[model samples]
Structures are given as structure tokens and as C-alpha cells.
Target chain A: MSDSRVSSVIQEWAYSSQAHTQTLNPTTTNHAGSTSQLTQMDMIPYSQSQGLVRGGTDDRVTEQMMGLSYLPYTSSSCLSNSSSTGTTNHHQGHPNTQQDFSSFLLPSLRAPVNKRSISKDSAEYRLRRERNNIAVRKSRDKARRRILLTQQRAQHLQEENQKLQMRIGQLTQELDTLKHILSQRHLHGAEEGVAGESNI
Target chain B: MSDSRVSSVIQEWAYSSQAHTQTLNPTTTNHAGSTSQLTQMDMIPYSQSQGLVRGGTDDRVTEQMMGLSYLPYTSSSCLSNSSSTGTTNHHQGHPNTQQDFSSFLLPSLRAPVNKRSISKDSAEYRLRRERNNIAVRKSRDKARRRILLTQQRAQHLQEENQKLQMRIGQLTQELDTLKHILSQRHLHGAEEGVAGESNI
Candidate 1:
């Protein structure tokens, strides 16, 4: 699939998940007005095209919509698991629906959805997703940078530790040498004392 | 002083320096044997006499010991500059003295020898100083634990950079609410959208 097409599907999925969330939870009413505005602004073109597709085969449309609806439920479930497992179960459950969606769209529906939604939801989705993608990328990059810095720091610390260990070895060696020198000096002093004793 | 007395004096200085380092630098060598041995063998006499001086010259002893010998000249420079530049010039001039003699005692020392030798020549000086103090504490800690673990990590990273900021307060508040509901319905969904959203 084309990059643009994949992004559009992801946006639709995001929107479906969001809509399901709004429907399931009423407390999100505070942002309802803005979300509805966004939906109307973003969804009108895609919805219109969807209306055109609706005319062709009612059964397939119903099945696809039903599958789309089920998506939000699964996605919501996936979102819930996101914290602990992170996309594992979501990815597991996603391929079936996503494959169905992709296959169904890949045929006659693909052309219409792509053309119409491209102007509206696709653009908005692309923009928003791009922005979000940038944010996620930035976040990941930042985390990566932190990890890189940390790794560098760890490397530097290990180097310092090695240097310190080397220093300790050197100091120990020097101390041994000094002790040897001191002992030699002590022997010389003892010999001098013996000579003085013999003369006395 | 006799050689035994000189050794004793050096050992006393080591003990005093160790005590001072423990006070100044908390995270240090974990080897308890040497420290405990030092305490039992060396500290008893000093502690007992400290009790005696707890009667007579406590303040004077503290004062004198404080001024005794910051033998790691770099450490003294660091202590001096800690209030100012932290660890600026420390690493630069270190290797010269450190590399030499690893055993040779310095002579005619520069600052009254502090009533004890604190020069680069002092093996005990390097060992005591380097073991206790590292140049990069915050960086090392940050690297060791990763930014995700520390509240201060966020603060420090934020201070270091202003670009990677997120709405932490809003995210945290939303997360708390989500976590509350998630705990309530954890059995029902067995998936976690809330967590995934929060991570994003």
C-alpha cells in the first residue's frame, strides 16, 4: 500500500477509536463541541464518499461498517492494554480487521475513499498524524538521545574507573618501590652505626 | 616523630580524611572490611581521646583536622571551586602528578605541607580522594537510572533542554483518572487503551 493510504487508514482507525470512546464515556462531553466540529469538518468529505459507496452494495457496506465499529471496541481494548503490554494484543487482534478493511478497500472502494478522503479527512488525518508522528518521533528521538548521552556518560565513567584503577595500581607499585628505597637507606644507617660502635 | 609515630600520624590523617570524606561525599567504596578495620583499630584510640577532648579541646581538634591536609590537591581545588564552577579544572591537571612516582613522595611541599603531605606524591591522598569523589555525579546518576525513573531527571533534562517538553500536568491528571477507571474495569477489558494513550 502507498504511504498516503496507510496513513489514511490509521487516521480512520484513530477517529473510529475516538468516536467509540466518546460514545462509551459521557464525561468527555466537555470536549464534545470541539470534537464534533472536527468530525464534521474532517468527516464530511469522507462521509459523503462513504455515502456513495453505501449505494453500491448495502451488505458489504454494512459488514465493513460493522467491522469498523468493532474496530473501536478492539482498539479501545488495545488502548487499555497499551500501558502494560504495549500494542501486543492490539497488534494481535488488529490484523484480522485491518486485513479485512484493507482487502475490502483495495478493490473498488479503494479508489473512492482515497480520492474523496484525500481532500478532507485524509489531509486532516495526515496533518494531525504527521504532527503526532513528529511528536512521537521527537519523543522517541529525545529518549534515544538521552540513552545515547547516558551510554556516553557510562563509557566516560568506565574510562574514569579504569583510570582510577590504573592509578591505584601505580600508587601501590610506587609505594612498594619507596618502601624498598627506605629499607635500603635503613640498612646503610645500620652499617654506619656498627662502624661507629667498633671504633668506640 | 619515630617511624611508627609517623605511620601513626599518617594513619590518623587517613582516618580524619576518611571521616571528612564520608561527611562530604556520601556514596563511596562499599568495602566495609577496610573501613571497619580502620575504625576498630584506629578510631578506638581517637574516639576515646575524642571523649577525653569532648572534655577539653573538641573544637580545636575539629578545626585542626579540618585544616590538616586535603592531599589530593585537585580535590582541594575542587572543594574550593565546588561553590563556584563545580568540576571545571580538575581533570586537566590531574594526570601529571597522578602518573608520576605513583610512589614518590613530593618534597619541600608548596603550602606548609598542611602539617601533612597532601602533594601528588601522597599515595594515600590519591586513593582517598579519587575513591570518594567523581567528577560527574548528576550525569552518572541520570545515566544509571534513566530519565524515566527520576522526577528530578525530568527537571534536569527540562533545564537542559526546553524543546522536548510535554504537558506533564495535564497528562498526569488525565492518567490518574484513566488509571482509576482502568483499575475498576481491568477484569472486563483485559486490554489497556488508557495506558497506550498515556504513553503516547
Candidate 2:
């Protein structure tokens, strides 16, 4: 909600658009049925990276708030909460540590933590990831809603069309029946007139 | 573009929405603050595990494709291209050998990879993600245009309102002037009549 966050989100959005334009342009020009994912995966890292950066800043702010609260109030409840969180983090961190170790199985992972630790970038990267994830959710909801609305509109139109067709068919049948009756009456009157003239 | 990818993307989208709704739901007994990345970090291990599975699949596909193209029926140019790609990949594969590892890094490398490695899921996710980004852009643009149009309309309305107020004021002034002139004429006529009567 911070101005900085909004600014960063906007900045990242611009970057994302440029990335999309670049990827789509290549697909159109080469006629290579390039997988949309290929372009997407290629572009996502930047967005993710941006998100991570933003997230880190947000995290820092949270940390600062926690730090400030810790300083002034010295509330026993707050301390207890922090301690409980620390303990919980420790418990959860274990599984993640095991998983992180496994990531090193990749040749890329052979490079020591000092070299490849996205840790420095992790804060911002994490933020961006979270933001992108949120944005992704929003868009998905929007799309689903759009699709649903479109389907509904189509159904309404179809119903209207069917009703119109039925009305036209009914009118046509009525017109035919009226014409037949009129013709028959006209013929019968002609015959009567002819017979009357003969009688005269 | 595969049906599977689409479905999973839909699932991912659904899951994300569920998560967001869960987060936003005020009625729910369960409340989680935006502060804790602890839950997110816990999920990271699962994501990493998923990433490993995906990496294996990608390697398997790449290798299988490489093997398939090994036959003589595959053109020399195609074979050469594959060989070059393989060599390039192999060379690129070594972490220590590369001076510019950043260039070699896939967007996936820096980001979290989900366990569901299907292109279908990713394609759908990417589609959703791109769509979301586009939607954000579109909504923002719409809002901006709306603001500008509203401002223009307001200015016009304000101008119109001012002109009307001025016209009302002018009419009031004219009425007042006409009343004063009529009253003065009446007074003069009354005085003249009185004077004439007195003279008679």
C-alpha cells in the first residue's frame, strides 16, 4: 500500500510489458510455433526478481516495525510472540534446510553458497514473487469471470435468436392459412356469381 | 496449449484464489497476518522438491529428443544443430567453466519451481500470468482515462455553471433597474397630478 510499493509495481509492470512484446514479436516473425510457456518462463524471472526486491523491502519494513515495537513498549506479550515465532521458525526452517541442500545436486548447485546464494537478492525476489503471485491470482479471477460472462451473454443471445425464429415461422404459417382461406372464398364467390348469371 | 497445461493452470489459478480468499476472509476464525514469510518459507521446501522433479523431466525430454535425432534420416544440418546444442548445453552445464553464468541461467533457475512440471501447467500458469499483467495494465489505463475524462467534464460543467450564475445575476440587476425606473416615473406623474390639482 506504500507509495514506493505502488511505484515499484508500476515499474515492474512496464518491464513485464516490454518483455512480453519482445517475446511475442519473435514468435510472430519467425513463424516458429514457439511455446507460450517458453516466452513466459523466459520473462518471469525478471518479474520474479523485481518482486523479490520489493518483498525484501516490505520485509525490512516489517522487521523495522517489529524492532520498533520491541524497543518502546517492552511488552511481555510481544516478546513472547516473538520467541514463539522464533521457535516455530526454527522447526520449519529444518525442512527447508534439507530441501536447500538437495538443490545442490544440480551442477549449478556445485557452486558454493557464497557464489550462488540468491540470499542477497532473496528479500526483493521474495517480495516480487509474492506480488507476482498475487497479481496472477487477480488476473486469473478476472479471466474466469470474463469467460463466464461471455458464455452467459452467448446463451442469452441464442435464446433470443431462437424465439425470433419461432415467431417468424408462426407468422409465415398464419399468413399462408389466411391466403388460402381468402383464395377459397374468392373462388366460391366467383362460382356463385357465375351460377346466378346463368340462372338469370 | 495442451489440455493438461490449461487444466493445471486453472487449478493453480484456483488454488491461488483460494489462498488469497483465505487470507482476506474476515469472517473466518483463522487469521494470519501479512507479516510472516514463515509459512511461505515452509512451502519453499516443497517447491524445491518439485523443482528437482521438473528438472529431471526436462533433462529426460531433452535427452530423448537428442537420441531420436541421432538417426541418419535426420538431416546433417539438424544433427549438427543438435550436436552444437548438446555441446553448448554441456559446456553451459559446467558452473566453474562459464564466465557469464547469468546469460546461461534460465528464468526458472532463480525462481521457485513447482512440483507439477507439466508444460501444460506452466503454459496455463504463464497464460494466466500474462493475462493478469495485461489486465492490470488495462485496468490502470482505464482508470486513468476515466479520471481525465471526468476532470474534463467537471471543468466544462463548472464553466457552464458559472455562466448560468452570471446570467441570473444580470437578469436580477435588469429587473431591479426596470423597477426603479418605473417607480420614479410613477412618482413624477403623481407629483405632477397633485401640483395640477392644487393649481386648479
Off by over 4 Å in 1: A1-126, B1-200
Over the stretch A86-183, how does candidate 2's per-residue lDDT look in tens digits?
Answer: 11100000111121232334543232333343331245544554456456644544433332233233334444454655655565565556556556
B-chain TM-score of model 1: 0.18
**lDDT (10s digit) by residue, model 1, range A56-149:** 3221211112111111111122111121111111111121122224344435333233333333223454355445644654454344334334
B8-75 per-residue lDDT for model 1 (tens digits): 32332333332212112211121221223222212324234322223332222211121212112112
Give the Å error, residue B161, model 2. 2.5
lDDT of 2 at B58: 22
Interface RMSD of every predicted model, in angstroms: 36.6, 27.8
Model 2: C-alpha RMSD to truth?
Answer: 29.7
Displacement of the residue A77 alpha carbon in candidate 2, Å: 50
Docking class of 1: incorrect
* Worst-scoring 10-residue span by lDDT in model 1 chain B: B76-85
